[model samples]
Target chain A: MEGLSQGEVIYIIVLGSLGMFLFIAGFAVFISMYQKRMLQEQEKRRIIELDYQQQMIQSQIDSQETERKRIAADLHDSIGSLLWAAKLNIAYLGRLSNFNGEMKDSYLETMKILDQSIDSVKRISWELTPEAFHNTGLSSSIMELCSRLNGKGQVIVFKEKGNQLFWKDDRALMAFRIVQELLNNAVKHAKANSILVNLNWNSNRLLIEVQDDGIGFTLNDKIRNGVGWWNIMHRSKMIDAAIEVKQNHQQGSAIELTVPLSS
Target chain B: MNKLKVYIADDHTFVRKGMIRLLNTFDRIGEVKEAANGNELIALVKKTIPDLVVLDLEMPEKNGFDTSKHLIDHYPEVGILILTMHTEEVFILNLIELGVHGFLNKSAEPEEVERALYAVADNDFYRNEIVNHALRSGVRRSTEASSAKLSPRELEILLLICKELTPHEVSTRLQISEKTFFNHRSNILGKIGARGNVGLVKYAYQNHLLELSA
Candidate 1:
């Protein structure tokens, strides 16, 4: 080392420094590249898990809907028919002569009771699966729902703007269910007095705004983790819709849903 | 004043039997025949046309809607009445447009059924509260822009029907025979491209033809 020339020594030092610098830079790049690959793998797995969850939820909803439809049909077709037959037979008996006043009164009372039961059956079947939802599209079905829900102190008003668009049955059903859920929550939980459901049709999307005057919800953990909230979120996700929850200024809550119609 | 022959069709044998028994009690209804479904009803109608054909909407083989359409196209003179558990306004409106004579809820009292039968038999159409409310509130499906316009008489008939007046009452008030009134009604339905009473009411409401009393 003492016999080495100064130029050679400086050159050796510079070469060593250059090699060290390159090694550090290479190490940094390799570490970063490895992290990038790990992140990509993690993201892929997350997406797969999300898709599997979505599929599971979808099938569950489908089966539930099918069950609801079947039950509604059974109630309407079987029980309702039997009740009608019984009512007719009772009516025929009433038409026959030689009944005492007491017997006549009892017959009338029985007929009245039968009538009430028939009404209850009709109401139950309708609630399970609205026949209007299948016959008419979402708009009229919602209108009918609003009318049905309007009379008992709580007033629900449905308004539409712009031209109505035709939606696929499944998608329309989801949207209807979401709206129904919102309305139910408003009536049952929020105890809203007056609710307004406005549907705005845009070129590529339908915007639904449900505003109510009731006890508004706080974004607390209870509400955030609620089953109703969970259902609304998952349903909106299934339809590829965007939902916004807004706490109203004075009272009540407002939910806005934007449903894309392109699909 | 001949006995009004009726044909009743239902999938449930008990319901059909009960209905027939109740109908038998009515002085107006006679020679009541029964069918298990819409197809059987159609075959029965082919054998001998009845004054009125009572239909249950949901049935095996052929449904009420198709059967009604066939009857409307083939036997225009036969009065069709729908008696089903389905009391939805949409169903009522659709059946009316298909030219059904009347619509009755399955839960309706025997007396109401008798009245509906007599109404259909007498006036060719029944205007119950259900039909009226449905017509007044329902939104019409946007049909093609019809260039055909309603004449003065047809417009008058449309307004009267929208006012909840029955066909018999409207004809009597207008000093026309029931046949002439029905012809005008069919013509009005055709001119406006309306389905039936529903279309007429919707058109009347949309065009501000009827004065809605609060």
Candidate 2:
């Protein structure tokens, strides 16, 4: 070994170094493959977690719809009939008191108004409870309500811009309730003169957009802390849609609802 | 004197008919007409120019607000009264701006309506006490506008402005002079950090200055 030529020794050392480098490169490749495998497992677990969350949301929605239908039916069928009977009794009271002077007329008038208020509350209750909601599909129902409301202040423009708005029935129902509640907020809170609503199917998603030229507001405002905003947000979760609420550049607030048609 | 012509606008037929009966019981109310919805009421108001219009808040075609506003704009001489079951301050606040001359809950005693008819017909403001209480309660919850130094009178005035009222009309409602009303409006704008009329209206709306009824 000591008698070996200098060139031969140098060649040996270079070859040995190249071999060590190849071994390290091979080990790095193996480690990279191991890391990729671990990432794939984590992703699979994450997907499972997401699926569980979706199922839980769906269960909650199903329960909520069932509850709404039940409560609405109770109010419409049970309480409504009772109110009607009471109203009829008031009319009957008119028959007993005929050609009355101011005092008797006053008595009869009080009775009649008492009956009218009962009726008004029942109607509002029905609208809130459920029966009125189901009789009409969400779009037509909302349009009817807003159309009725438009007569109140400035014209509230309500229109659906898309062709295929049919969604998973639960999602549709929840979406309908959400829009109804938001419209209530607009009318009651925004002091909005004109409310413009847009609903449509965008690409593969069902989109609901509510914009108002009235007083626009940020979503995180304290007024949104109650059941109204909570309901809208929970419903958005049901359809896997992300709601982008921002002030419209012109003057108002625009709520953009984008829900995927497919899971 | 001739009877003051009266027309009724309410969604419920029973209520409208009841109102018609109540008004006719008095010799002061004459040629009582009835409309079941806002559209009918508007058409009737335009056609007849009734001395007094009694409208309900929740009606189809045109609601009480629109119908009343239309009547006020087109027939300023005719007194408009809002007879509603809800006496929420917010509703009254909104009505006040619409220049609604009289406010009464449907739950009011029959005499209240007759009194309201007389006062409104006489071109006087009748602020239902229940409504004031509701407004006071609603204001208590939203204090965002409290620090702005808006006097109670200014708040009442601010509410009317929100309904898109002209300053002249605001003067008539509050019994203030045109000059004072202008000065107050400017002061209100300055205090609230609002630029123009819209800005004032927007700030009032956002700060829950408008007594909003459910």
Candidate 3:
């Protein structure tokens, strides 16, 4: 050591300092990379959690729909048959003509009431889950709905202008449900005298417009009234569709949904 | 008055009771036998062949499909009238293929039931408007499938059945023995893949043997 020159010592010190600087820089890069990996893992976990939540929501909705369908079928098959049989029995008695004047009058009146009851049962079951919707597809189901509403003194008009559109069963069901909700809101809240529905399909997309000429709710009112809005928004998101509800006191309420199609 | 014996096959007891009461009121209806399910009805029917059988499709033990098949295969003489709650066109069409004498909704008036009973007893097909509409639509949907060709004799028998002629009437009209007429009807039913006379009519409709416009 004593024999080493001063210049050699200076060179050794410089080399050592350079090595130390390089090690520190490498260590910093390693730490940064590790932190970045952890952030990515956390992001992935959050996405998976959101996906699980969406699946849960979808299953809940599916189970509810299944229950509604089962109940509707039960009502139609069991109670509906019984009512029909009762109606027939009464009709038979009325034919016998053995009843006196007052008795015959009561019998006729009973027949009328039974008829109404049967119709009511049919309507309730249909509203729960329409078998017609499944059998005939969306357009005819909607037409049937409008006709029933019209029969009951509500003027609901349906218009379709374009090529006939076909949709998968589940998608059609969801769309039908959305329309039903909108019409219900119009009937219950807007107190609308008339409702207009338009369904149009073009080359790449389908558009649905439902406009009511009744008391309308503004954007603020919609935000405040959260009962059915949440359902509509959730369903819209589920189908990868967009919905816009516009309303004002003077202009009435209007809702439009735009859906993209693969075909 | 032709006193006709009728058998009722339904899962619901109330429906059975109501039908029995209505049948009792009809002067032409003699005995109204009640069975809870198709199996019970089959057993009772084997013992005593009723002039007509009223069946509901969704019965327990044996459904309307199997029951109708059994009846047609064993006792083809008994007329079958289906009274069901289902408004499905497919179900009605399938039953027609089973060769039911008539198809009526459970909601039909007692008068309709009486009419159907008399119609079947008279060896004629009895279908209300609902059944007709359903079958007409079925024909339109299934016009693509062709049926086996019928001989002139078989075609004559089919037309007579469509006219609601009984086997005896058909035999008398053609001056053939009842047994021979039965053999012809069976052969035709097999050739056309029909379960009974109702299926024969449906076949006639599908092959344009019967005019849809008419």
TM-scores of all predicted structures = 0.80, 0.44, 0.77
Candidate 3 residue-wise lDDT at B98:
68
Residue range A19-71, candidate 2, lDDT tens digits: 99999999999999999999999999999999998788678767776786676
Residue B174 of model 1 has an lDDT of 99
Error of 3 at A60 (Å): 1.0
Model 2 DockQ vs. reference: 0.02
Write the candidate numbers in order of decreasing TM-score: 1, 3, 2
CAPRI verdict on model 2?
Answer: incorrect
Task: Report the candidate with higher DockQ, 2 versus 3.
Answer: 3
On the 0 to 100 scale, the lDDT of residue A237 in model 2 is 80
Which has the higher TM-score value, candidate number 1 or candidate number 2? 1
TM-score of 2: 0.44
* lDDT tens digits, residue span A1-263, model 1: 36889998999999999999999999999999999999999999999999899999999888878898999999988999899899989999888765778997899899999899898888878777886776678887777778877877799989999888755377887888889888888888777899999999899999999999988766663375487777788889888999998665448889999998766
Q: Write the per-residue lDDT of candidate 2 for residues B1-214, one digit (tens) a residue.
A: 7789988886666666666666666658888998978889877876778888888776767888888777777787777777764444555555654556777755555567777787666524454565455445445434565368788988887888766566678899899898998798788978886644434554565576665542
Ten-residue segment with the worst summed lDDT in candidate 1 chain A?
A216-225
Model 3, span A58-149: residue lDDT tens? 89778878998899878876887687668767766766668878998898788778767767777888888886555567776776677777
Candidate 2 runs further than 4 Å off: A1-34, A99-106, A129-135, A151-154, A160-171, A199-208, A240-246, A258-263, B1-214
What candidate 1 gets wrong by more than 4 Å, as runs, is A1-35, A97-105, A159-169, A198-207, A211-226, A248-252, A258-263, B137-146, B149-214
Clashing pairs in 1: B97-B195
